[model samples]
Every structure is written in C-alpha cells, then in structure tokens.
Target chain A: MTEKAIEISNLKKTYSGGVEALKGISFDVEKGDFIALLGPNGAGKSTTIGIICSLVNKTSGEVRVFGHSIDKELEAAKRCIGLVPQEFNFSQFETCKQIVVTQAGYYGVPRVIANERAEIWLKKLSLWDKRDTPARMLSGGMKRRLMIARALMHEPKMLILDEPTAGVDIEIRRSMWEFLTELNEAGTTVVLTTHYLEEAEQLCRNITIINHGEIVENTSMKDLISRLDMETFVLDVDRVPDSLPDMKEVSFRKRDEATIEIDVPKEFALNQVFHKLSDKNINVLSMRNKSNRLEELFVRLTEKA
Target chain B: MFSKESLIALQSIFIKEVTRYFRIWVQTLLPPAITMSLYFVIFGQLIGSRVGQMGGVSYMEYITPGIIMMSVITNSYSNVVSSFFSAKFQRSIEEMLVSPVPTLYILLGYIFGGVSRGLLTGIIVTLVASQFVDLEVHHWGILFFVVILTSMLFATGGLVNAIFAKKFDDISIVPTFILTPLTYLGGVFYSIQLLPEFWQTVSLANPILYMVNAFRYGFLGFSDIDIVHALILLSVFILSLFSLAYYLLTKGIGIRS
Candidate 1:
C-alpha cells in the first residue's frame, strides 16, 4: 500500500465571526505525489493549509501527517512537514541566511547542521549571493526563494506551499516550477496552492479543486483534463487562406493573417484538422492550446459550486 | 524535564529574541541606561541634597535600590511586550507557532530574554547611581533572590500583556497609564512609612509595593512590609502570571483563528 503524506478527515472550521470557512472537507495526499490544491479567492484553500500546519484551529477534524495524528502527536506530525505560508513571515531585519538557519533550529537541528544546510539550500535556490543581505533588501522573487530555502532547511518529508509564485514573473516562476519538480522527483511529497492553473496542469499529477468551503473536484490531473469536452487551439500558419475552411467536428476562425483559432471537441483529432488545412494549401507553422485545459475545468467546477 | 529537541527549540527562540533586541540596541538597550542615569542625577544627587535622610540612610542611598528596581521592572516589562507584540504585528510569530516547539518553551524563551535585559539595566542603573551615593549590598543573597524574582515576575506579566495586545497602541497603554503609576507609587523614592496610615494600608494592595519593599530589604536590611510575606507574594504573582500567560498561548487567544 502506498504511504499517505496527509489524511484530512471531515475537517471543519468556523471562524470566530461565524464565517464558515471550511465545511467538512476530507482528502488524502499520497506520499511522493505532486498535487495541486487549486481554488478561487475565499474558497477555503488557505484555511485548510493553515489547519494542516497547525496555524489555524479547526472546529472539529482529524488530521494525520505520515500516520502521526496532529491532535495527539502534534510534535511528531509537525516534524514531518514544512510549510511556506502565502505571505512573507520572517523578520525583515534578519539576513537571508539567518532566517533559514533559525527555522532549522525551531525543528531542533543543531546550529552547525543548520548552517551547512542553509548554505546548500540558499545556493540551490540561487540566493547564495544574497545570503548575507537583510531580507528587506531582497527583491520580491528573492524573498519568495528565501522562504522556500527556509522551509527546506530541516529536510521535511512533505512540503506544502500556499501561492508560492503569486507575484513572481514568468522567468522566475518557471525556474521555481523546475525546482519544485526536481524536489518532488526526489521523493518529497509536494502540495501547493496556486492561482496559476497552467502551473497546476504542468506540475501536478493529481489536482483538487475547492470552492465555497467544499471540495468540488478531486481526481488525477489526467482524468480531470480528459473530462474537458472541448479545447481551443491557436495554430500559426504560413498565411491566411482567402476563404475559411469548413469542418463538421471542428470550428475554425481567423484570428490574424498568420494565426487561426480552432475549437476541437474531444471526438475530433488535430490530424484531421491538419489534413483539411493541408488540402486548403495552408501550411502550419506552430500550434498551442488556446486556453489552459485545467483552467477551463477549474472555472466550471468552482463556478457551479 | 525537557527533551533534547525541546531544549534546542528553546535555545533557538531565546537566541532569536536576544538577537532581535541587540540588533536594535539604540532602541532596546540604550534608553534604559540613559533614563536611569538621569534619574540618579536628578533624584539621587541634586534632589537628595535637600530631601535629607530616608529609611535610616541618606536620601541618595535610600533611592538607589529603588531606582535600580524601577529600571529592572520597566526594562523587563517593556522588552517582552515590545518584542512579542512586534513579532505578532509582523506575523513572524507564526514561525514559532507552526513549529514543533512547545508553547512552554516559547514562553520561557521570551521571558529569559526579558530577564536578561532587565538585569543588565539593573546593573547599569546601579553603576550609574554609585557615582551619586556610596552603594552597598547589606544582604547579597536576598538582593540576588529579590532582583531575579522581580525580573521573572515582570517578564511574565509582560508576556501576558503582549498576548492580549492587538495593536501598537495597546502595548503602550498599559505601561503609560498603569505600569508607570504603579512603579512610581510602589515606594521607589519614599517609604510607605511616610504615608498616612490609611494610604499605607491601601498601598499594600499594590503588588509592586511588595516587590519594591522586598528588593529594598535586600539592600538596606529593613522594609515597611514583612520580608517573608513580600517574598511569598512575589512568588505567588509570578506563578499566577505564568499560569495565565501559558493558558492564553495554549488557547490561541488573539493569535489564531
């Protein structure tokens, strides 16, 4: 049987102000699985993460991290998990290295070991040069990376990040994705909450969509993507044909002289569309999805809830 | 007994708290030294020349222990309140809350940090007063016990204040409106013997009076209050405040949702 990284059963949380943030949601994240917990704003994603990390108290629930019950074996449960909160929570005056080393110390890692690990993680995250600089001096991207390095200092078995790339640029976001992929590949159960649906599709093997304090969709990413009834693709062509081609299974429209968009249902194949375009003497230069598949599915699932 | 991991976790928070205060020495460490020095200059020397004797000693010598205790109380209380409140304000306190560190360890770490600052300030005030009067410790053992207990009690009280404080203003309100008045009336400059009988009876209700009188007894070998009762009262207050702070933390009051 596969080990479970996390098991949340019938979790519920109602804030002091009578806001029901979570209403009896249950889920399990398998060990070593790369997963995404995607949700729209105010959809209980953060509350769930906060409860898992012991930051937010739950109304009633049982949470186990690697078989250690959070309510009973709290210390043991916390020891197995590392959390990167949605916001920057370290002291602004502390140096990047100090922030990471101090985090390791909270987990009982010796100073010597913490220093060595801080050096390695900082270097790996491209923050070695900024290690000695105060956290306030770093740019937005560097601060995010510093939080990641700090989370990894104790070498936790599972890592959970809440919107870790919410404000990062494309280049840095892609680099972060690569690093997370590598970390997941090395047997760290990685669970992340992100607004970027494309990031979820690209990195997660399984996805959970939440809305209105409930889980709307929970399944393998492939299964979820397969459920999409239709997809739109933008095809770059050598030139626009004088007249548009007609097809029964696919709808084609001219976006520009060099680009054409096609809505292809699951029953239709791209090869058939290419055959029709070739017959029209329109050569294809490149092709890409018009919209992220998970994004469309995410919107549909969350909107219905 | 604490486990090894808990000890390391305690050490981590303790070091972090110390580092935070030291990092802003101008704001945290310097003010008390400067403030206490001024008190020695104004109240001990200039004013003592005219005020004459108190508690069987020159006014300067009488106020020396009181001044030192005052510095210790204020510095210790302010240190923990400001540091803990700032951590909460910045949300950095979540770092410890999410870790495996026990709540007791967190409490002790910040209290120890406050005690360190308090004792350091006490020493600084004492050294500064030495230039104003012939400083002496009549009973070194009682002096040490009283000073240490006083710091611990105030530090614990500071933690309680920090836990309940929601904003920057909330942290200062207690010190300004309550703590300062209590310290001033706690027999820092004049003994309770000088007060009218009724006012003296009322002053005994003040917790700070017990601490100050006990601390004074350590230096001058005499007190307006019973030394044993004062020690017992100090211990009781410390225990009560420690329990309250621990309960607040465990309940996640004003911190967790």
Candidate 2:
C-alpha cells in the first residue's frame, strides 16, 4: 500500500469576520507524488495551505503530515514539512546564505551540517555566486529561487510551494520547473498551488482543483485530462488559400492566410483532420493547440464553481 | 519542547537576535552610550552643583544608580519592542512561527537580546558616571541582583508590547507615553521624600520606582521604599510579565493574521 504524504479530512476554516475560507474539504496525496492545487482568487487556496503550515488556525477538521498529527504532535508534523509562501517573507538585510542556513538551524540541523547543505542547495539553484549578497539585492527571479533553496535546505519530506512562479518570466519559470521536477524526482512529495495551468499539466501527476472553498476535482492527471471533451488546434499552412475546405467531426475557420483554427472533439482523431487537409492538397507548416486543454478545463470548472 | 533539538533551535534564534543588534551598532548600541554620557554631563556636573545633597548623599552620587537603572529599563524595553515589531512588519517572524521552535524559545531569544542591550548600556553609563561622581560599592551583590532583575523585567514587558502591537505607532505609544513618564517620575534625578505624602503613595505604584529604589539602596545604602518589598515586587512583575508574554505568544495575537 502506498503511504499518504498528507491526509486532510473534512478541513474547514472560517475567518473571524464570518468569511468561510474553507468548507469541509478533504484529500490525500500518496507519498512521492507531484500534485497541483488549482483555484481562482479568493477560492481559499492560500487559507488551505496556511492551515497545513499551521499559520492559520483551522475552524474544524484534522490534518496529518506523514502520519504525524498536526494537533497532537505538532513539532513532528512541522518537522516533516517545509513551506514556500506566496510572498517574499525573508528578511531584506540578511544575506542569501544566512537565510537558508538559519532555516536549516530552525529544523535542528547542526550549524556545520546546515552550512554544508546550504552550500549544496545554493549551488544547485544557481545562487551560490550571489550567496554573500543581501537578499534585497537579488533580482526577482533570484529571490524566487532563493525561497526555493531555503525550503529545500532542511530536506523536508514534503515541500509545499504556493505560487512559487508568480511574476517570473517564461525562461526562468521553465528553469524553475526543471529544478522542481528534478527535486520531485529525488522523492520529495511536492504539492504546488499555481495560477499557471500549463505548469500544472507539465509538472504534476496528480490534480486537485479547489473552487469556492471545496474540492471540485481530485484524481490522477491522466483521468482529469481525459475528461476534457474537446480541444482546439491552430494549424499554420505554407500557402495562402482562396477559401477553406470543409471537414467532418471538426470545426475549421481561417484565422489568417497562413493560420487556420480547428475544434476537434475527443470522438475524432486529429490524424483525420490532417488526412482531410492533405487530401485538399493544403501544405501545412505546423500545428499547435489553440488553447491548452487543462486551461480550458480549469476555466470551465472554476467558472461553474 | 525541552529536547536537545529545541535548545539548538533556541541558540539559532538567539544568535540571529544578537547579530541583528550588533550589526546595526550605530542605531542600537551607540545611541544609548551617547545619551547616558550626555545625562552624566548635564545632570551630574552642571545641575548637581546647584541641587546640593539628596537622600543624605551628594546629588551626583545619589542619582548615579538611578540613572544606570533608567538606562537599563529604557534600553531593554525599547530593544525587544522595536526588534520584534520590525520582524512582524516585515513578516520575517513567520520563520520561527512555522518552525518546530517552541513559543517559549522565541520569547526567550528576543528577551535575551533586550537584556544584553540593557546590561551593556547600564555598564557604559555606570562607567561614564564614575568619572563625574565619586563611585561607591556599598553592596556588590544587591547591585548585581537589581541590575539583572530589572533588565529581565523590562525585556519581558517589551515582548508583551511587541506581541500586541499591530503597527509601528502601536509599539511606540506605550514606551513614549507610559514608560517615559514612569521612568522620569521614578526618582532618577530626585528623591521621593521631597513629594507630598499622597503623591509619594502614588509614586510607589510605578514599578520603575521599586527597581530604581532597590538599585539606589544598593548604591548609597539608602532608599525611600523598603528593600524587601522592592525585591518581592520585582519578582512578581517578572513572573507576571513572563507569563503574559508567553500567553500572548502562544495565542498568536497580532503576529498570525
């Protein structure tokens, strides 16, 4: 049997102003699984992570981290989890190396060992060169990566990152994704909350979507993506066409002389569209998804919730 | 919470707190040393020449211990209050809160930072006053006791202040309006014997007065309040403030939200 990395049952959180941030949501993550928690703004994603880290008190329910009860064995539970918050919470005056070393110290790593691990993590995250510089001096991307390095320093069993890639540029975001993928591959159970749906699709094997303070979907990524009923693709053609050709089981429209868009339902094979286009003697240069499948599903699910 | 790992966690926090204050020495360490030197110059030499004797001792000598106690109280209280409040404002305090470090350790770490500052300032001020007023050591044991206890007491109060404070103004309101007044009227420059009987009774209510008088008693072997009651009151305030600060910390009053 697979062990559960985190087991949250009937979790609820209601702020003092009577705002119900979470309403009895429950889910379980198998050990070593990479997961994404998707939600719209004010949909209680942060409140849920806050409760998991014990930053926000739960109104009701139970949370256990790696089988350690947060309420009863708080120290043990906290020891197994490291949190990378959505905002930059580290001190501006401290150097990058000091931040990570101090974090390791909080988890009871000896100073010598903590320093060694800090060096390793900072080097791995491409921050070793800037280790002596103050945190305030680092660029936005470096700061984001600094937070990740600090989280990884203690080697927690589960690393929870809340919008870790927010505001990062595309190139750096992809690099961070690679690093996190590598970290997850090293057997750390990773749970990420992100606004980027494509990142979720690329990195996560398990998917949990929360909307309106409730879990709308929790299943394997394969199952969730399979539930997507239709996908739209844009095909770039080599030659200009006077008019577009009609096709079966697909909706086609010319976006421009060189580009055409098509909606292909799950019932039709994409190869059939290519076969028909070839039969019409249209030279296709490239084809790409008009919209990311998970994105469309995310919008549809969150809009309904 | 009392395990070996907790001790290491405490040591880490303590080191950070110490490093922070020392790192900003101009802001943290130098100001108190400069302020106390100015006090010795203006109050001891310039004013004591005219004020004559107080509490059966020269005005300069009589005010020496009181001045030192004042520095300890003010510096200790301000140190913890400002440092902790800054951590809250920057949201860096969440580092310790989310860790396995116990709440008691968090409070102790900040208090020690305050205590260290208080004692250092007191020592520097005492040395500065020594050059102006003839130094005397009537009871070294009581001198050490009063100085240490007074620092601990105010450091705990500062922790409570920091825990409840929501904004920068919240942190200053207590020290400015309440702490300054209490310290001034606590007889740092004059003896309460000059006051009317009823005002003397009210002066007794200020906790700083007890600390100052006990410290005064240690220096000149003379004090308006009973030394025994002063010790008892100091212990009580320490216990109460420590308990309240610990409770506020565990409750996550202003820091959590």
Candidate 3:
C-alpha cells in the first residue's frame, strides 16, 4: 500500500501573544500528488506549513510524514521533507552555489555529493551561470529560483513551497510551473500554497482552502470547480443592443458598448441562451469565462466561513 | 548518540561558522590583534617602566598571559554572540531548525567555531607580546588546558547571550556592560594580592579571575589563586554554561517561534 506524504490531525497553534493561528484543522496529501493549499491573507496557511516543517512549535497536533510521526520520529520526518519558506531565509553574503550546497550538508549529504547535486539543480533552475554570485546580487526571480534549487538539493521525497513565485514575472512563473509539474511527475509529492488561483487551477489536482484557522473546503480540483452554482461569461457583441432579452434563470448586465456579461446557473442551457440572443438579432462575436472558476469558489467559501 | 549523519551536519555548521569569520578577517581577526598591541605598547612599556617588576617577573611579562587571556575571553564570547545572533536576525538559523540535525550537534558546531576564533586570537596576541618580551611556557600542559577550557567556557557564555538576544543591540549589551567590566577587574593588570584585604576577598568572587590566574600560572609558574581550584572552577563553569546553552536551544528560546 502507498503511504500518505503528509497527514495533519487536529493541528492547532496559538502564538505567545494569545493569537490563535490554527484552530484544529486537519488534512492529508497522498504520496506523489500535487496539491494546492489556498487561503486569503492571515488565513493560517503559513502557520500550518511552519508546523509541518518543524519551524514553528504546534500548540497541539499530530503530524505524520511518510509514516513517521513528527513528534516521535522527527528526524526521520524532517529528512523526507524540503521546505521553501515564504521569505528569503538564506545568508545574503553567500554565493548561490554555497547556499544550495550548505542546505544539502544540513541534510547530511556528503560535500562531494552536495556539490554535484547543487550543480545539477542550479542548472535545471537556470541558475548555473549565476551560481558564483552572492544571493543579494540576484534579481527577485533568480532568488526565487535559487530557493527552489536549494530545496531540491537533498532530493527530498516531498517538497513544500510557500508562495515560491510571489513576485516573479509571468515568464519565470510559467517556467516554474513547468518545472514543478515535471518534479511532481517524478514521484515527488508537492504541496504548494499560492495566492494565484489561476495557477492552482492549472497545476494542482486537488485543492484545500482555509480561512480564519479553519478548513472550509477540501476536494479534488475538478469537483470543487464543478460545485460553483453560477458561472459568468463575457460576450462580445457586434453592436450595442437597444433592449434586453427576457430569460429565465439567467441574468445579464451591460458591461460596455460591445460587451455584455451573462450569469448562467448550472441548471441553465447555453444553447437556449444563444437561440434567445439570435432571436433578439444580437450577433455574439466571441465569449469567454469571466473569471477563474477556482477563484469564484474560493471567494465564496472563504467569505461564507 | 552520535551518528554519521549528525557528524556531517556538525561539520557543516562548524565549517559555515568558520568561513564567516575568515571571510571578514579584517573585522574579526585584525581588531583583537591591534587592540592587544596597543595594550602592550601603552601598559607593558610606557607604564611598566615605572611600575617595576610584578609577581617575580618584569611588568611586561606579568601582563602578557593576562593580555592573552583577555583576548581569548572577548573573542570567544564575541564570535558566538555575533555569528549566532546574526543567524537569528537573518532567519537563516531556520535552515538548521527545518533539517534533521539534532540540537546537540548544532550547539557543538557553534561552540567549536567560537573556540576556534578565541584560540586564534589568543595566539595572535601572544605573538604580538613576544616582540616586546621573551615569552616561554612554564608548563605546556597547563597552558593548553587552561586556554582551551577558558575558550569553551566563554563560548558557551556567548551562546547563552545569543539565545537571549532579541536584536543586534541586545548582543552588545552583555559584552559591554557585563563581560568587559568583569574582564578588566579580573586581575589582568594587577594581581589580587596588591589589593587590600577586603578588596582581595571580593576579587575572589569574580569568575574571570580564576581563568586569568589559571592561564597566568601556565606561563609564569605562579598565581595568586590556587591552580587546582582554578581548574576545578573553570570545569564547573563550563559544565554549567553548556547545560544552560543546551537547555535554551532545546526550548527554542530566541531563534524559534
């Protein structure tokens, strides 16, 4: 039987100042599965990640990684996990190569093997040419990539990244997506927490949304998107209409001279809407989903919580 | 229990710490040497010419061991304080926190690094002192024992200070207000024998006096304090300080949330 990569049971954390960060939330990530952990600001995402990585002391919980309990077999659990924190936590004085190799050494990899892995990972992340430069000298995107290379140095079975591409440009972000997809395909369990809902829809197979220290939604990506009660579509028309079409279970708003937004319930049919528009003598130029489906569900879930 | 993996982690942490000091040699190494040289020139020559001999030797020779001990004490304490506190401030210490390295190995790694800097600075000060006076070790075993143990004690002290430090300024407060005052009054310039009966009794309460006199006995073959008692006191202090450092680290005091 395959083992779960991470299993958090009733995990909770209260800061020294009496702020309750995680209020008994629990979840699991299957081995080799790519999952997105989505939440809004101050939603306890980072606190949960920090407890899993042993960076923050959990007030009470049972967290297991690959069959090892974090409290009883902490060393074993830690050895299997690699963490890319939300902030840059490496020394600014050290070169890129030094930072990655040093991380391998922390995991007990020999210096020779660490050097080899550092080179390969840096090269894979497109940072080999800049390996000798100090970390402070690297651009924001390069710094993020350097963090990824460092996280992969020990060849961990699971990689957890917290906002790894927070400030990266679109080109670099897409490249990172491709890299993460390739890594996950190679049997590495990846748990990502990101603000970009579209990226989560494109990359993760499953989703878990948290708010106010509670788990509000957890399911497969396909199922979660399908649960949306209504979807808004933007239609570009050939010309502005003089009057609106009277339709049941559908609502329309005039966005502009050439654009109209229509909200279609899950029970409604798109063909009937097109026929009604045809009857109205309004030619639809093109149509597209108004916003990311996952985003819509995320907003509703967090707001409801 | 010591495993191969933990050994590697210890070596890595030690190497990283050493590299930090070496990388900033001008700031870490050079200053101690220059500071001790000034003490030698001003106190050992300009002032010693008038003070005559001390403890059955020339004034310059009497202050040499004390000067070396002072450098070791300050450098060992400063190395661990600055390095560990900087790691905390930059949040780089989380690297070790997230890794599988045991807290024992991490503490040992940093303590060894501080010891290395302390000994190196001691040797540099000794070399600078030799230019002014012919230096000889009266007892090589005692010399090595005292210096090493003294460095260990102060390094552990530095670790405790670092663990309690919340800011860069916090690291300096101990060194300036506490460590410096104790070192200066700890019989570096004058033997406690020169003090009045009451002050002499009071000097015995200071811990740095034992380290300085123990180290001084290694050089001149005599000390105002008993060498055996000095060694015993140094060992106890090291054991106690190490326990405190280990406890603080395991509790995640300053470096962890």
Shift in Å, residue A109, candidate 2: 1.6
CA error at residue B200 for candidate 2, angstroms: 0.7
Model 2: per-residue Cα lDDT over A189-296, one tens digit each = 999999988899999999999999999999988999999888888889985576666766788888887888888887777777878788778888988875589988
The top-ranked prediction according to TM-score is: 3
Estimate every model's Cα lDDT from 0 to 1.
0.90, 0.88, 0.92
Worst 10 residues of 1 chain B by lDDT: B128-137
The alpha-carbon deviation from the true structure for residue B131 of candidate 3, after best TM-score superposition, in angstroms, is 1.6
Candidate 3 chain A lDDT trough over 10 residues, lowest sum: A239-248
User: In order, what is each prediction's RMSD in angstroms?
Assistant: 1.7, 1.7, 1.5
Q: Rank by DockQ, descending? A: 3, 1, 2
Q: What is residue A49's positional error in candidate 3, in angstroms?
A: 1.0
Quote model 3's TM-score for chain B.
0.99
Judging by TM-score, tell me the better candidate of 2 and 3.
3
Report residue A226 deviation for candidate 3 (angstroms). 1.0
Model 1 has an lDDT value of 0.90
User: What tier of docking accuracy does candidate 3 attain?
Assistant: high
Candidate 3 local distance difference test against the native:
0.92
Q: What is the lDDT of residue A232 in candidate 3?
A: 92
Model 1: per-residue Cα lDDT at residue B123: 87
